[model samples]
Target chain A: MTLTINDFADLRSAEALEAALRAIGAERYHSNHPFHHLLHSGQLDKGQVQAWALNRWYYQSRIPMKDAAFMSRVVDPDLRREWSQRVVDHDGTREGVGGVTKWLRLCTGLGLDEAYVRSEQGILPATKFAVEAYVHYVRERSLLQAVASSLTELFSPTIIKDRVAGMLKHYDFVDEATLGYFQARITQAPRDSDFALAFVKQHARNEEERQQVCEALLFKCDVLWAQLDALHHAYVLEGGIPPGAFEPVREQGRVAA
Target chain B: MTLTINDFADLRSAEALEAALRAIGAERYHSNHPFHHLLHSGQLDKGQVQAWALNRWYYQSRIPMKDAAFMSRVVDPDLRREWSQRVVDHDGTREGVGGVTKWLRLCTGLGLDEAYVRSEQGILPATKFAVEAYVHYVRERSLLQAVASSLTELFSPTIIKDRVAGMLKHYDFVDEATLGYFQARITQAPRDSDFALAFVKQHARNEEERQQVCEALLFKCDVLWAQLDALHHAYVLEGGIPPGAFEPVREQGRVAA
Candidate 1:
């Protein structure tokens, strides 16, 4: 079902609006995807997990681009000031640090080559499409919608906790330092999503505006969900790999046809 | 593998560059995808066909937007003048005419709701991402690369002929009238692609520019191939439909889990 702006026609209060937005994450977030189930439950093999980390690095690398796109359109100094931190968080104050670098550490920790992950040649075509869509959505949509899209971060903390604990417990290759990206995001995401959620609630004052916010969150969920769907389809399911996507150097169990 | 500008270091002549671009198509085009084989070989059921038509309508509907984006970035009046015709062709001189309208007719002819198809809610997330990537590539890339991306049309005439002929021969529900979109494209695509090919060959004069052109065309082929990959993975291979994509009202063969 496609989400339309008219779906939240009756939502007027800020609390009600907040509830609607949270409801979208509850129902549509990538955490609900079966791939997440596989990842968090340690049901996937090392190569499959390698594929996950490798594909996810693309999304991680693009977060700053998405934020930059969002920031380029914002005129308010305060909003820009608040939002610029996200760019720093991902890109870092200098090279060899920040979230993207940390993600590279996780990828390398998984026994994948750093250059291969950075080149992003082996990632599924669907992963590229989905990540690019998020950047475009932020660039093209209304400020309310753009801010609301980041509300996916509002739900990320729980997933991060679950993921960190699950991966540490289940996977021998992943260690505390390797998962630094998620460890940082557990704090960073709440701080970012809190600001974004407050901004969305304050800005989206009417029914139509509220609906746009809800739909924006839904769209963001779709972005995240679609990425996992691609990963699961390509790496996990039988005979699911597309031509030209990343092939693991060592096939753990499921072999590419 | 990630296609880089360095990949075309040996190709200096337009003829060589053209061969390289066409080689990418021969190897990577959606015509080579399994979904197209199923589509053209009359292997899929009506509901599956409906899913194909409905999802494709999103792509068909976005052509004008993509063209308009390209035209918007063109400061050259002559270039814009030549390019604007594509928008006219897809959007039509009148409301009930044009390629998008004809695609709607094709959808309705395939038993899909016109409004629903137009809403584009049912398109796979991968489809949206791939199509939007094309538009974004045109908007952000050098104008030379933008024009080169349209080179997919160079290969479209053959695919359209095979599709129209195969669908007419195999499917009882479709007639030549309902398949007017492909018939129109049989003439229109070559004309558009010829102009685009000439523009790319003439503008991409040096080795670096030639490499960019090749990468651009390869990128466009990836865009097309990726969409089919999504459809095949979701609808044909393993019933791995992402949430909120079009669900066939009747399960023709592969049942959604």
Candidate 2:
């Protein structure tokens, strides 16, 4: 459903505005993409799965930079303090402990080497484009849009659950340790999304501002959907390996076909 | 093909520097993507073609804005005077004439309404993300990289040649008039890319700056490739349409058994 800001122009309560934005996600999020269907069902081949993880690391790595850009712009100390945790959440205290470390572990479990993955020398051009776009969005657009894009965290928990459950049940090679990232994320995503959603709702004052918030969430969804699309196109359909993406193995029984 | 530039080193000559930058485009440009093969070959369905034109319009439309941004930063009168014509080339003196208008005409030829195409309300999130990334890359990155990204136009004339030739040969519906955009682009791109290349070569004096120019071109390749990935995903492979991308009409024979 296409929503015009006018629909919520007269809204006085935050609850109604929140409901409308949530409904946008309920209907439009990446969880609804068929590629996700393949992912959650374990219908994707190992290469496809690897592509997902490798491409995702780009997204994972950029969070802190983009969030820092956002935090740097915030004048309010209390809000900056609250938002700073997001940077810590992704970067972690030491080496292999935080969200980025977990994401790297996920890539490692997929058989990607630490140095190569860190180099980002193996990711698809499309993945880089989409991920960088997210970083740029956070940096350039209004603070409200930055916060709103983070609202995709609103729908991510459900996806994480489905992904964890499906991979565990359908793929024998997958195990809890390899999936440590989601364990943290299952809790972390909600906390992050909740903070973001509340921030957006509270801060987005006029109808125009509210619409920008919605558009930001939609843009985040596209950032994600575009990633999957690149993976599917390069690995699943034409099988055209872009110049730098992960190389799919030559297993005969591979299911991506 | 990876370049390492850790310190500031001066260049030997503009010719050698221009060669290095062009080499970057040769290796990284998105004309090499498989999706472009389908696009120019007319292998894509009507919807896929429509999605391409529509998504690309976002990039085309932004040419002037990016040029304007670059112009805003330039301190030299001669440089700004030469650069400002890019804005005129894109936005034009009056409506229905400039590069943007010609692009919209191409979109109209592909079956999109002028208002719908112009609203850009329906462009894939990835397209907006990539294009916005380009604009911001110009805004924030080293001025050298900003100039370097436009170096894709260095390779664009070849892509334009192949695209026009292939489209004319493969599609019954496409004609030269509808592709006036490319015809103009043929001359304009070479001239533009040439100027940008010379500017970068002369300005980017050291190895570190040279490497940034190369990486900038790679970043730009990602931008173009990502746009195609979004279109391929939304309109072709996954068959899932985002809320507002082009809606494909299913042909009777095109349905899978």
Candidate 3:
């Protein structure tokens, strides 16, 4: 059945809400985007893949910030305690260990400059906009919706698996080590998404609240899908790269010493 | 001269800063984008034009919100009063008027449903993110930088002129009435942009602040360029329409009832 906002106006049981939220993922998640199809099937060249990794670093780096925004408004110590782990997962207890660092390694492995990737100077303007929208959403929305937005993580493990397998099999630049961030996230996303899903199911008691939860999840999916759309557009289609975004350096043969 | 953050960090005169800002527009504004070139040259078919108008409505509709967000943070009565006119220009003093309503007229003139346009359901996801990013930028950044971002208006009159003349000259579906918004903006943007420009000049006194003012203008240009990039990618180049964005209905031959 096609889902509409009106359809969720009547109270839904927790199970029903959960199912609706998952249905949104099944229908709208970034995994379904054509760019991902190209990415997984080795259709994109190294420069194109580097563009994806560089732009995505903007999103990955902001996870801690999004989580921090959520945690600042959250009052419950137990909820805060559980939620703080997401920050740690992304940022790590120390430098060079967390998701962001691993992502940087992936970029460097693909021959991108570490400083350029970190500066976010070369990312597509769309990537910056969509990722920042997520942070602002967490900062400004109701705490329940903030938590609900994180539900995209519920669909991540499968994408991670497919990505890691596909990248390892198809691309020689990427190996298991370069894909460490996904390996870490395969476990972390589920743990975080589980808590968030439970929190949303528990807190979204009324129909209006449930609808908000569903909308939040769908919004998160849009954020993810928009990024890939940008990648495909710039790197794959007409090569209409906006001024000042990353231009991958195609390595020429080394000079004989 | 190549514009760099460091170039402005040395504290240029107001004339130099203004020139740099104008240079950025010459190089980077959406007016310079190939899609706009196609649009003004009337290379895009009616369906393609509909997609442009429909997606652009999201940006036009949010102008008041972005202005309001900027105004809410301004403590000065004079500044707030001057900036408030932007909201008025877009939203108008009454219903069935203003820039947004005029934009809808253009959409309807192209045969799109008004409610569907207003609902923003057909807008590219990238458009929503980029436009909302503008709103959030105004809300979160320093008031001077917020004002600087509006300096794109300095470049608007020429674009508006070209767009109107080109559309009226080349397309039968478009007439002066359908282009009311550009006609209105041709006068309004310069007036609003002049006030903003003066405010930015007066407020951005130091080297770092000048750099920020320039950077803010560049960022705003990116916001505009990215929207057109998305349109060209989705409708023009690869036909990789994201699942739920506007799909224009082709008018087939009349059928016997």
Best by TM-score: 3
For the candidates in turn, chain A alone yields TM-scores of 0.94, 0.90, 0.94
Compute the lDDT of residue A243 as modeled in candidate 3: 81
Question: Candidate 3, what DockQ?
Answer: 0.54
C-alpha lDDT score of every prediction, in listed order: 0.84, 0.78, 0.84
lDDT of 3 at B73: 91
Best model number under DockQ: 3
Q: Candidates' DockQ values?
A: 0.41, 0.39, 0.54
Worst 10 residues of 1 chain A by lDDT: A248-257
Clashing pairs in 1: A1-B244, A122-A246
Worst 10 residues of 2 chain B by lDDT: B248-257
How much does candidate 3 score in TM-score? Answer: 0.93
Stretches of candidate 1 off by over 4 Å are: A1-6, A93-95, A238-240, A250-257, B1-7, B75-78, B250-257
CA displacement after TM-score superposition, residue A92 of candidate 3 (Å): 1.7
The list of candidate 3 runs beyond 4 A from truth reads A1-11, A250-257, B1-11, B250-257
Error of 3 at B186 (Å): 1.8
Ranking by TM-score: 3, 1, 2
